[model samples]
Target chain A: MANNKQYHVAVVGVTGAVGQKMLGMLEQIDFPVEKLYPLASKRSAGKTVTFKGESVEIIEATPDAFEGVDIALFSAGGSVSKQLAHEAVQRGAVVVDNTSAFRMDPEVPLVVPEVNPEDIQKHKGIIANPNCSTIQMVVALEPIRQKYGLNRVIVSTYQSVSGAGNDAVEELKDQSQALLNGEDPETNILPVKSEPNHYPIAFNALPQIDVFEDNHYTFEEMKMINETKKIMHDSELKVAATCVRLPFFYSHAESIYIEIDGDDISIEDLQNTLKDQPGVVLEDDINNQVYPTPLSAEGKTDVFVGRIRKDLDVANGFHFWVVSDNLLKGAAWNSVQIAQQLIQQPGGLK
Target chain B: MANNKQYHVAVVGVTGAVGQKMLGMLEQIDFPVEKLYPLASKRSAGKTVTFKGESVEIIEATPDAFEGVDIALFSAGGSVSKQLAHEAVQRGAVVVDNTSAFRMDPEVPLVVPEVNPEDIQKHKGIIANPNCSTIQMVVALEPIRQKYGLNRVIVSTYQSVSGAGNDAVEELKDQSQALLNGEDPETNILPVKSEPNHYPIAFNALPQIDVFEDNHYTFEEMKMINETKKIMHDSELKVAATCVRLPFFYSHAESIYIEIDGDDISIEDLQNTLKDQPGVVLEDDINNQVYPTPLSAEGKTDVFVGRIRKDLDVANGFHFWVVSDNLLKGAAWNSVQIAQQLIQQPGGLK
Candidate 1:
């Protein structure tokens, strides 16, 4: 059982939506683990989670909780990560954080395994996960960048309600039901949780996905803009984003307009390159109604790319639709992939 | 009662989605009438509708149904309109058709009351109501065009399922419930009812809104392209559309990009103009989360315009988002507004 001596991996905030998905992904990928610890807030301490066909009781997360843990996966809120993330790192555990608390830090590697796996080596004990919208987009664009150098990216996202958390999904459901029942709906948690005004997400589209930033872009939009450059390790890559929350419950979709440095590349050539890329699925047959939908990509880990066509007048511009499970590829699966990549690196595990 | 000796108006296909909205508009804005006839197919012939607090029986639409009618509003499917529209016109009724059946017909004047009310007089016998997407875009763009000539328009829509008809709404509802219940959902309509396959619209987005046409664009997309040109009465205008159906049930939202002939127009000037325009509400204050959303625009007749800004790196390009109830500004309210405009004109009455 020497091969089983991999690592004792602990999942912080195990009761939350993204944390649950991380556990499901861990089982799905069958990660090499010596032991698993499920930690949550004190209120959820005694709750049980099914991990790899075994029920594990959740423990209250604290700095002392990571005494012997080799890997700590953090999907808790940003405040929680800010509080305990350094504590976990101080105790000699490598932390893969799924919050924005450490993502922009100069020391933490904002990693998407496919796009910046090598960045993992430079992490100062804490590797940060890029925003969900940024994760799927970088996944689709990285291979393209490697093939044809990227110059600019303009993305408009159709994000799902689940990205706001489980409560937002329930709010959408309740509001839709209220509308159908010929009653007025009550909205308290969408378009931004901490914001004063709540817009109904049922049968509607909201242009602001997250709280507004001083630059006239929402925080969600800025994440895509800033995180893209950080993940690609190119501060000069021009990026803009318009993040929108639609009435979808799962999977985030984006319409991306990208300008490549090379002009002679036909759409067919780009399609051929994307078709062979790892963790990417091409669904771009426009004639036969073949394209990716958020519902179809709900439980899948692969980023689905389609609508690959040249822009009407721009010579080097290409437009495509990229969709992936924001909770999976955007969060849980990417963390697991990063862990696996860290294990596979030349310097063996501690 | 003697003052009731006004023109006799007939509403064909009165029981359908757009037809019902037309009826509501007729009631909401007192369209003068001596008598009103509600005509539908055999399936809805005997149904009773309350118009202006009076129960009006729906008559079966036939050639003789328009005998003494002065104005006819047709919103049935294309086949019904193609067959019955000519008959209504021959019977001295000025038919305002709301289907794609006559939108592209050279002899028909496609009208949006604000943009092309004068075009209503040019109708051979019938005026066409442009597609819902086109109606909203042109209404927002016409003022801009008047101030600075418009050269090109490229729009991508996040449309609602209700645009397909009442059945598509039912499919979305049923499929959502089925998916949430962990059951296989049924899909009998959508993307095109006559097409071979049906896809579940719950938690999904379909790129094709209507049947595919010879030009490789869906009929809905082509309808937007052709109808925009026709409604603007400028055949030389370059219009391109990508119409996508999201799971939204009410209002349609569009991201419109336009290139104007003038130079160096500031975003503030554009916002001020839209704020003063008729049937348009400006909601472009990004500092306070003041952007127009489909939920806020539902059941409203005004086009909610916001996110107005100059395109980056393009001199004459500007981008905006427009939202309005598809059933209102796009179809029913537009038809009724045209009728009111005609009534206000010199030769509008018999």
Candidate 2:
């Protein structure tokens, strides 16, 4: 049963935006699979999803669905993950939960494979995926943190609507078309779906990504703040984030300013360090107008980092713009990489 | 002619976006005008621009056009301002320039009436206007800086295409329309009109605004950094900025972080101080999801401040979002205000 020729994998929440992406990610990475089960809520259970050029009927994602599943990817919702992740773990499957349910839990490891693949080894049956905005940022900044000894981070995110969900993506397109036709755009899902009021994301920027916390930071902003500390294993690191939802449908961009512990690190020094990192693509040539836009980063797994320059006043401070596909590197590909790295380690399949 | 009632006024760059808004702002503020002269390039001249319910022909913006003008408001390009602003000034017209030409000139004052009405008195012949993005941020932070003793500032701007010019605005609309029709968006005037590369701004964010300077900061970003110090008269203050061109068409929004010298300043304290400021409207109620977006601040003359919260780690550090119509407060309305504020003062119109 251990390190078998091929493994049975079940995709929970197979009908969701990220869940649907997991199938393609697994195929893109060429994950060895003996059997694939697409699992969703009972309402969406009967639909078939194409995985590796074959239609696989989705089964009910109850506790019993985890039977014989060696790996389970959960993206249904927080409630679904909270209810059924333990059941999958009980059935001898490792769970990669793509929800906020267990992200801050002490028992779970929030894994971004590029930054902390080693943390996956300590996962007690469940590994949490960090938020989309947090994933791309850590991938870019972790190298800098390691080489330069990071001191502080202040990030302002320009996130895409897909980070909200598929419905929000549709809302953006519909709204754009409506506005183009001189009609009022319908607002049903943006900013937050569960929130009472919704705003149009077409040709607009919403400062609130998720709901606002008591401290006035949005839930998305706090996730970037708290998760960076936990993932970087630096409790004393000062971090602040202002997460905003922009009109794009693919990648998330960040304007990140950081203060480093190292002295006199030049832009070339930073670029040379970042270029050596495997997951980061350095696109920082200002003379040629070389930089990454969300459109340029669409559907790409690698994080694009550019606009590297020193702060005008603060000698130790540096700033850059980072962008990546929120769905790919931010969600499904990260989850797939975690699962892939999980099995590569010794005694990885418990 | 000094303090003459209903003085003759000239609108430079009358066919441009900010120029057109200048006409409306002059009317909205009800400035007493004996006659209006709309000036544009020779090609765009001869077109009638309606003002005060009558057609006003746009005269060619020549040196002789300033003959009888008491006050000339320039929004024409920088070269035009450079060539003609002084010509107008020699003809005894006080120039309120909206270009980057004279902003950094020590003799000419960079005035945001809300922040530095007194600086206008130092103007030799022309009073320079700050950049649209800088004008809005300084307006929001000046009151805070005055009350709390400011220390550091970091701003990331989400600017509209209209800040580039009317062609950029049409580029966005045409690109959005093309994108909605499932066609590739045309790119001609975005990021910078004169730059070699053009990227689609439809559903995309471009980190570059204006051309990149020698230090890798965009001209827009350097303007924010340099102008903030000059306007606040605090060269020792730490300021950094990242100016981005978003898909929005009207208002420019900024995510600003500041560290003040005062201790234990609460969000309520900041809000109380900001609300009392005349030009900044406080719209920060997190519980009800009340904050300003680009859409909400469109067509408004006031700078909107919201999402006020203190940083989690830095006791003296705080963050807020500011938005204002880039064409109005950023350019036209501000210029009109300077002119009105000028005429109200004795010995103002020389």
Candidate 3:
């Protein structure tokens, strides 16, 4: 691949929230795309999605859909990725999967380009993207980890409905409108779509994110717990998570507690380190009543951190808040950044 | 007083949300009230409240309004309590102050009947009610602390706007409806009412509960930390808090992490102890997807605990979620219960 040559890019689930954001991120980053394949289920094939003011026809995703496709961004579902990811690879396309398909697979590199760019070079045919909550948290914590060593992490998340899908977003909007009209808000898709129970997210908080595993941790919690260890490349790092779905439309907020290995690191020390990070913006100023909320972080690409303080008892313990748009930085922008970093490698993506 | 004797009660701030709930709680508990005096500010003095189907006239609260009153339940702002609480006590009525004006005072005893009923006997004139978020958490954690000694605590709260006041609840409702109608929601009462800045709480989460202190911890967060230590009677306990206000209407939910002293406590051991707690209901069955949400715990009086699991690492660490109505168990019901317990003392009101 030459630097001047353009690439053919395919976006699976082109009409979904993350997929639509992926198209916007590609254009905003000015990625040179020679062709765009808007891929979706057979039911949606005839429809079209606009890319850079040009309408691209949707293609029904199948084994043959990956022909001549240089890169495929998959966010349809875990089942969609598990089904056609290998098919895309067999047809000479690299899959940047945004599901839980191969995140823990040793052969597949799970990358957050800011934290572990070197790991991207080891991907065989597919690269895994971390969960939305995990992606923002690690980006904020990585700066601290590089300056001081990290010992333990415990996070409680306030997530938005968009992370579930575009349908979940509509469900929240409909529910809000219904409740505002003094009617009952319908619960069709939330907590987990496939699960038996559906809880309303209008003016409510659902503690369960994904289905519960044998250990009683929701799959979403386990993803944060497991993915943080993998992406930081320190399996010995201690992580615990409590993921809750709030009524917000976009951006996920987390209250995180981390114990660093620095002996006498002050709040100023931690602030300076995070302020210098590339993709992170430090919004901390308690005297000025400054901190990031879900509403303030919407449509932003960089991870926003504020509300930093040291634990009253432990000298090394610190607490902070992190927020980022789940659609862009958590899913679409993260996937695009990985692709951008991969192409910039010497000799290009091998 | 004899066992058959009835008491005279004055409901201060009678026009406020908690004051109305306090009247209901007194009736629900069938307290032996000889007379009910509904007291409020000059603006709300003409308003009337329903007690046992009777329209009780609201009296303007003043230093002299406590005459002939045996018990006073105060829920107005801290300034109101500071101005008139001693005046009420000087008028010979015992005050159960709900504001933070007297919680940390050495002479005033902070009591959560389930956690520290014994502290009620140490009060000179005023019995202080703990913060709403702290009350529910202490009830759930007290049982665990008894069976498996405790070491440290870290909490992130999803508090309701109702905890602020009736006006904040109206702000959330109006803002939510406005946004549903495709208009920008108004922001004037959230994050903090008196603070210079107000953030929208509809369809979003606000990280600041009350005003920030000099230490960068919000007043609500500091209340949780200091009040827990005072109520638990353990100054050496390590506690940290991050309080966040959400768009919910009635209940406050807390994600709490505690490091206990038990050597080999299994999940069931912790569950059994919490189930047997006097004022707590255990709702921790992940297989059936049974956990308490704000919507489910709206009108309930008991603290609902669920999602109990041992930390993946740290054999002595455990985490759980607790929810209870901010008005009922958090304020009104707790105050009424304390008054009931105070009368049950050996010689009645000392």
Model 1 per-residue lDDT tens digits across residues B247-335: 87888998777889877898887887788989889989987779888778889999989877675546787778899999999999999
Error of 3 at B14 (Å): 0.9
Off by over 4 Å in 3: none
What's model 3's lDDT at B318? Answer: 90
TM-score of each: 0.92, 0.99, 0.99
Model 1: CA > 4 A from native: A1-5, A234-236, A261-267, B1-5, B148-153, B180-182, B214-216, B233-240, B257-267, B286-288, B309-319
Residue range B1-350, candidate 2, lDDT tens digits: 24558978999999999899999999997788898989999998878999989998889999999999999999998999999999999999999999999999999999999999999988889999999999999999999988999999999999998998889989988998888789999899998989999999999999999999989999989999999999999999899999999998889999999999876889999999999798999999999989999999999999999999999999999999999999999999999999999988885565
| Candidate 1 structure lDDT | 0.85
DockQ-best of 1 and 2: 2
Worst 10 residues of 1 chain A by lDDT: A1-10
Q: Over the stretch A141-246, how does candidate 1's per-residue lDDT look in tens digits? A: 9989998999977777888999989999889888877866778889899888888788888777888877776645678877888888989989888776777898
lDDT of 3 by residue, A300-328 (tens): 99999999988988888999999999999
Cand. 1: chain B TM-score: 0.96
TM-score of 1: 0.92
RMSD of 1: 3.0
True contacts kept of each: 0.40, 0.81, 0.72
What does candidate 3's lDDT look like per residue over B1-350, in tens digits?
34977888999988898998999899988998999999999998887888988998888999888999999999988999999999999989999999999999999999999989999999888999999999999999998887787789999999999998999999998998887778998889988888989989998888998888877889999999999999999999999999999988889999999999965888899999989778999999998889999989988789999999889988899989999999999999999999999899999986
- The DockQ-based CAPRI class assigned to model 2 is high
